[model samples]
Target: MNLYPVLQTADVAASARFYRVHFGFAPTFEADWYVSLRHPLAPHAEIALLDSEHPSIPDGYRERARGTLVNIEVDDVDALATRLDAAGVPVVQALRSEAFGQRHVIVRDPGGVLVDVITEIPPSAEYVAAFAPNE
Candidate 1:
């Protein structure tokens, strides 16, 4: 499966900084409101933070919040949340224990893309069975 995210943002540089400093992504190409950053350890999609000044997305882009809210599944939600907060990126959803088997935090990017940072927790036997749904 092609599990990559191509997100839309208004501030390419800001988004690039967020990904680069927080997620360890280094940019390969950078232009006005256009950039490509990749993770050295894992496969990451090329994110494009469109410039609001010269928007190519047309009018009424964020009508119903269209586009990918990239879900960043991590191992340490709390730590990451703290880092993001300290970096001045407010968390939309505080780190919470999910009913399933994970902890998650939501944050909005420069272009209003909601990023869900998830950290999986050990699943209970019942939860596992329910998810497995097999005899």
Candidate 2:
């Protein structure tokens, strides 16, 4: 299965700029109130920047901080996090092995979106043996 992530931004224009300048992602779709951006390399990704001014935005969620908290799989989460942290990017989390066979970390973008950087790990023999215990 494929995965996608979306987040509500306090200001659509401001968020769009961050994606455009920092990530070089441009708008695939835009309106007076909303904009959806896509990375040139990741054409399938559709990260929609929700407008706070939009009529449908819930009041409660509006006050809550807007963050992505999205887990994006990479080749090496440790190296990626180090490079990002060295570049002055604040890492909300750190790389560590997870039960899902991955090491991951978190990033909070300018739009208040939290992105989780992940790298898949090979399944452990013990884990593979668990389901096949009877074998």
Q: Name the top lDDT candidate.
A: 1
Per-model root-mean-square deviation over C-alphas: 3.6, 4.7
**So what's the TM-score on candidate 2?**
0.67
**What lDDT tens digits, residue by residue, belong to model 2 across residues 1-135?**
745455666777876776665455779888757788877774455577776656687666554245337656666677777877876767777667876467888877766777787887765666765453445
TM-score of each: 0.76, 0.67
TM-score of 1: 0.76
Q: lDDT of each model, Cα atoms only?
A: 0.73, 0.68
What would the per-residue lDDT of candidate 1 be over residues 116-135, giving only the tens digit for each residue?
Answer: 88898876665776575549
